[model samples]
Target: MSDDRFEVVIVGAGPAGAAAALALAREGVEVLVLERGDFPGAKNLFGGILYTSVVNELIPEFWENAPIERHIVNRRWLTLDEDTQIGLDLKSAKFDVPPFNNTFTALRSKWDRWFAEQAEEAGAMVICETNVEELIVEGGTVKGVRTGRDDGDVEADVVILAEGANAMLAERAGFRPQMGPRNRVNAVKEVIALPPEIIEDRFHLEGRQGMALEYFGGAVKGTVGSGFIYTNHDSLSVGVGCLIEEYLRLNMAPYDMLDEFKAHPMIAPLLRGGETVEYATKMIPEDSYDSLSDLYEDGLLLIGDCAGLVNPSIHHEGTNLAMASGVAAAEAVLSARKSNDFSKARLAEYRERLEDSWVMKDLKRYRDTVHFLLENREMVNEYPDLAIRLIRRYFTLDDTPKDDVIKELWKTIRSEVNFLKAARQMWRARKTML
Candidate 1:
């Protein structure tokens, strides 16, 4: 290969790009990965959970050597009101063992760089701080990419677009349509430093075990979003995110929501006395599978957020899907290489691989969830408060008879909500989300 050419070029060095580079490089494919950040993960942010099943496939027993902070053995889901919360917490000792249930908490800034290094060590040429200006397209075929550097036009047999949610290059190249606000989520996060002992005590964790907590309803001021807090070794990743369209429609700011989340009565005590060590913001693609953009074209494939691979359901999965898409992209490229074919038909294998994997299956399963929640805002906005009120009333030590309390609760429910409509909504929720 020449200095200005490679067999495959990947834009963005996040999990997807790095995974693809590593896989292709391991197979002796000449892959080049370009990253716009000062280094990989410098500009990436997530809720702190790294689902490592895909990583384990790439590097068996990755948790043994990766810069993993903690293995999550406890998961909690909470519904919040102004000053009250109802929660369900699940803990499993099995998750604390070897595979750790494939869930771990990691700081992206540290993890991304480490992952890219693995790709580099495997023979992929990773160039950081080099922004891909655009794709070099000729006769509707992607030839390579043009970067911001001198002699920037580097040619490649195929180009993989893993450029995060913004997908500027993909948009510019018309590989996908410009994503609207409703199809995206804006999030802000803070890494709050605390004593390790305090973290363990407060979260009921032992050793390197961690807990992941997700909040809905008042968490984002009843917006179509959620808040998350993940326990790290000596810090907490706290953040809130909602639909970009919700942010605009409600005239709200992500930072303000994050502040509110941190200040919530139930949330504040956990983060008390902690110092903020890092703050970052990110955009996530929440597009439904039915609305997903074209995955492949001649000489090109889009993976990760750029391809809208996010599963925006209760699962809250993104990184794992991104890495899986990366591996699939690499497989497709390798297949095409065997025939020296870089046409759209040859690259269709990328989509087929993803369709055959859990990545696409989960996305398809919850394709209607985001839209359903958006349309039925009452499920998130009103139901949590109502449930909390009823539960609080039930647990209150009042002089009234228990039967009277149950009757009163039923009366309140009848007065406040239409039973038929509520039942219908619940059925729809089950169909859309379950």
Candidate 2:
């Protein structure tokens, strides 16, 4: 093997690439991880939760040393109306203890760096500021990567693409179809800083406990989008995201929606005296399992968002899926390497492993969720309004009688909601998610 050739080459140092590098390095494989940013996390703009199961397995008790912001012990799912909001708030003592299995909030800038460091510690070569221009294919078989450098054509026995939602390299290589606005979401986020005590008091948090608030309905100004606020140690990660097609169709400004959401009657006071510290934008592939591209060919494998591994379920799970795919890819490569085989047929094991893992199973389970939501935008736009109206009237003292209010509410629902549509959606949700 030449000096520049490696057993495996992983593009993008996000969770998937880093995880693969770590696992492969531990197996003493010659793996190289390339990042286009100045550092692993420098270009990442995620402001969401990370489920720790996959990562925790990679690094036991990772929370002890990781750059985690907060351990979420409280969850709030809100539906905002014009002047009112309704939602569920559940706090669990079960999630407050060690491991914090529920989830935790983190800034990708710091978290990704730490994760990549783990890979480096395990003997993986992670190079930053290296742009992998294209995959080096020879006679319809994947071989290596061509980077933007004088001596940049680095050969590898196998290449794992973890290039994220844009997946330009994968698209250019014909490994996957170009992602469309219909299946993508443009999210804008801001990290608003406040005193730790103030944040604690505001979000009803105690100690290192945190809250995650997810908003629907008017939060996106009646658009097919959603908003979120996750408590950090001393900052709040607040953002709104909507389908790219909806954004373009409505000529909606994501930042403008964020502003309106911040000014919400219930949300504004929580950030009354906070200062915005960081702002970022990211494109998330929300299309479920059906939209996933081809998983493997020749010596190439696609994992994470580049492979459409994001679960578009209400959970919005991406990180865990990414890590799982990474680990699975590493295992497949190790198995293939044992036989000194690097063929498309051999690499196909990666797909089988992913399907056998929760990554594909969970995604397949929620395959119809994004489609159902797109077909029924009213669930995010009008239904929340209807719900708030009904609940408000029911609680109002001006109600003449309880039974009368119930009858009136039923009449309002019958007039405004398409029962057939509602029934169909309910059935679809039951069949797909339940």
Per-model TM values vs. the true structure: 0.98, 0.97
Candidate 1 lowest-lDDT run of ten: 1-10
In model 1, the runs with Cα more than 4 Å from the true position are 1-3
Candidate 2, residues 1-434, lDDT tens digits: the string is 13499999999999999999999999999999999999998988765798879998899999999999899999988998768889898899999997886499988889999999999999999999999999999999888999998789889999999998888988888888778888888999999999999999988889889899999888887766689999988899999988888888888788888898998898898888999998889999887677677688999999888888887766878888888999999999999999989898998899999888888788888888777777877767777789899999999897388999899999999999899988887788786755
* Residues 96-174 of candidate 1: C-alpha lDDT, one tens digit per residue: 8989999999999999999999999999999889998889899999999989998789999999999999988888777
lDDT of 2: 0.88
- The C-alpha lDDT values of all candidates are 0.92, 0.88
lDDT at 130, model 2: 92
TM-score of 1: 0.98
lDDT over C-alpha atoms for residue 430 of model 1:
92
Tell me the RMSD of model 1 versus the true structure. 1.2
Q: Give the per-residue Cα lDDT of candidate 1 at 91.
A: 99
